[model samples]
Target: MAKQAKNHAHRRMTHQRQVISDCLKTLNHPTVDEIQTCVIRTAPTINKATIYRTMNRMVEDGEVIRIVGDDGAFHYDATLDAHYHMLCEECGALSDVDMPVLPQIDQYFPPDSDFRLTGHDVIFRGICSKCRAKKAGRNRAETGQN
Candidate 1:
């Protein structure tokens, strides 16, 4: 048992693995490029290929989840539970939405709809607070007052 535990720990604790895990733990949803930047700061010797491979391995091992945004970029989430996310369209901010329970939509769908409800992702896309503030500033500037 000890040998097996040690082996498992070894499998999960490479230099790139540690850097990838650290990057995931620091943010809600970070893109590969973002994570690569962070990893480079800590482990300058690590390259982009190592970061990508480690992240992919982590996803395959169920240590992380990959979220594809509308921008065609893949974001990594360290949380491995069933949950939803909201993306700010203007600022590209990603946030998690808390739910007491998952909504029951099976009752609303017809049996012959051919849509299997294995899982769902509810992402609310809207302008974030910072973007709203920027728009307000622009409006003020255009009004030539304040």
Candidate 2:
């Protein structure tokens, strides 16, 4: 009976991990609602509460990264890699910035201070190309410019 219980526990953990992993793999920087929706498609028995609990646990365990977008929504990322994010103000889109990570920069800050730097996240906020073009077209129409 003890062996059976252990196996059941292991299987439960594996399923939970798989659900979170599948959602992360399928979506990019998805919100909790998006994850719940995706997981429900595969495991209808899993509810929003379960997804929320599992995702929160995974974030606490450092298996996932939680980023707050400009719109104040939490986005989950499972890249486990060092990278930055770009947020579009007009469209509220979150995208990964593929820039190189500079460890020296972290060391350069407060060189004489006692603050230990673990890591950093840099987010660039601006209008995306689509929004910019739309604004430009509107301006041209108003000003009678081609």
Over the stretch 67-140, how does candidate 2's per-residue lDDT look in tens digits? 99877888999998999899989987788888897777786688787887788888899988889999999999
Clashing pairs in 2: none
Question: Which residue segments of model 2 deviate by more than 4 Å?
Answer: 1-6, 130-146
Worst 10 residues of 1 by lDDT: 100-109
TM-score of 1: 0.80
Top candidate on lDDT is: 2
Candidate 1 clashing pairs, residues 3+ apart or interchain: none
lDDT of 1 by residue, 19-135 (tens): 778877886699888888888888888777777788888889988888888787889999877788889887677878786435675466676877886666678788878899999
Candidate number with greatest TM-score: 1
